[model samples]
Target: MAGPLAGIRIIELAGIGPAPFCGMMLADHGAEVIRVERIGGRIQATDPLLRSRRSIAVDMKSPEGVALIRDLAKDADGLIEGFRPGVTERLGLGPDILLGDNPKLVYGRMTGWGQTGPYAQAAGHDINYIALSGALHGIGRKGEKPVPPVNYLGDFGGGGMMLAFGMVSALLAVKNGADGQVIDCAMTDGSALLTAMTWGFRAAGMWKDEAGTNLLDGAAHFYDSYECADGRFIAIGSIEPQFYAQLREALGLTDDPDFDAQMDAGRWPALKEKVASIIASKPRDHWCEKMGHTDICFAPVLSMAEAPEHPHNAARGTFIEVAGTTQPAPAPRYGGTPTDAPTPPPQAGRHSDDLLGRCGYDEEKIADLRKAGVIA
Candidate 1:
């Protein structure tokens, strides 16, 4: 608790995926996010998504457990849940109930669909959510099925990150004397918002509705990946005229008329073929050595194992070791109140006694609740 959100406490209704991800982000930035899991529940310790948070396990269906959460909610600045629309209300922990007690609390609801949409209660995942948001429609190669970006767009980007932003924004509102509010963070809505720039491109007639046919979507020869002789790949993003000129100079294609007209979209496929052939003649390292530090927008497409060891990543401390696991560091660096390295995730209910003590329960009262199987 050393960063901007140091004293802000968040009560998380234990859940999988984006909800937990949101909690992890808040916890990473110095929020005291207390995770309330069901009795005997466990979130895999290796999942970095749950890092830096303490947990309490309780029988959420029991009236005692419901009261336990309500008790904690009385002093929390916010609450986040990823259950389907009505699940929290069913648990009697919905915004109306919690906000009634804590008028300044920011309540964040993460879901695939929103609270009152027709598909609000439907079962869905990242692919389905982005598909409905029109994000998936323009994602793949022409004549190919849309490839899912492995849950990044809808789950983390849309759902978890959006929920975190919404929660902090609401907290700022509370600081400005606004009452507590509910944030319906639907993946569909978030995904669509994430496509705002592309939507603008489409509106301005600079983008195509079809997949793999736009300037930045792998259609342009200078803005795509090329295979190397070693079968590895390198990415090229020579989008600007100067960068494209540097690309031509680096590859000795300056004299070639085929590459001279870099903006001719119709000639992209043939130019891409010629460029691919040239790149495939050399290994990935060869191109890296030739243009790695230039304005050519060139870099080897490093794999996960290689990414952390890269010089830039190492220099930035972009990845860190926690519980013997290497994962990304807390991001959007703070200047005055920098975040501390996150602690490893604790076992569920590891701080049950300590957390309960802060909630006004004495040792004897907590022991009785533990005896009655109310908390673990």
Candidate 2:
């Protein structure tokens, strides 16, 4: 089988960041995603998000190019774009135009802000979007400014993933005889949704509004990362009483009264210092060996380079080699529709000739368009 979405096709308006990520996810699951690029553009092969798709390059500003995109989108199951709200419409490739040709097309729009918000047309990035959504405020230590989580929260985790989900849902609806509709996916909205659990905790009085003071935040001694002797670190999550007992026993602190009040906020700083000192006395690997098999809830902190090689990750094939690049494998493994290994990102315009041919443009016409600077 060609994975779960074998027959599905997606038309991706080439863009940086989240929009490409959504296309990658769809293509990874066996959807035929055609990425439209600028005539002279080249794929950044190092960008794993651009993987698993064919690319067709055209001068999107040209009428012929816009017409080409509309024709391709006419039969596509979904179309994803990340330009600002009115950009596609200006190019005449907006939902109204494309969906008119393909009545069952799912048009997914990605933006940091929604189409008609106060800041809708304002320029922004992942940091700005998440900051507005209240997700960034809960990320850092209490005394420090909120450190961005490397753009994961707003871009891929929220925006791209949300668009992917919207596309799949809309396609499913189309399969069930429903007409396609536009999906307005804003990173801000998705980022706020990502904080649903935090909202619940705050409402129930189980969580503090501050960053570092909450149960899962870095302030909790039992659920934080501790630096070890060699400057490496380990994470701890001995949250339950039984697990906390195992932690205390592992550190030979079972009889210590200072740690007796596990939930007392006042004792946390002192307890955290003690735990840090203990962890610092040993190297991360030593502690990993000591508590690796126990219920102390431990894991040695690993960088990206070390993660794929970890025993657990290797055993599960969580990462795979793609075109000589070690990248994450397809996720949420399917029992009956196992996804195929992903193809490397294609060079821009790599499939232009074939794609145009498939779109009903003959060889002479394709050659003429390329010569006229409409395609590459």
Clashing pairs in 2: none
lDDT of 1 by residue, 137-218 (tens): 9888877999999999999999999999999999999999999899999999999999999999999999989999999889
What local lDDT does model 2 show for residue 274?
A: 95
Note the residue pairs that clash in candidate 1.
none
Worst 10 residues of 1 by lDDT: 38-47
Off by over 4 Å in 1: none
Clash count in backbone of candidate 1: 0
State TM-scores per candidate.
0.99, 0.98
Q: What is the C-alpha lDDT of each candidate?
A: 0.92, 0.92
On residues 202-308, what C-alpha lDDT tens digit does candidate 2 reach at each position?
99999888899888888888999999999999999999999999999998899999999999887898999999999999998999999997888889899999999
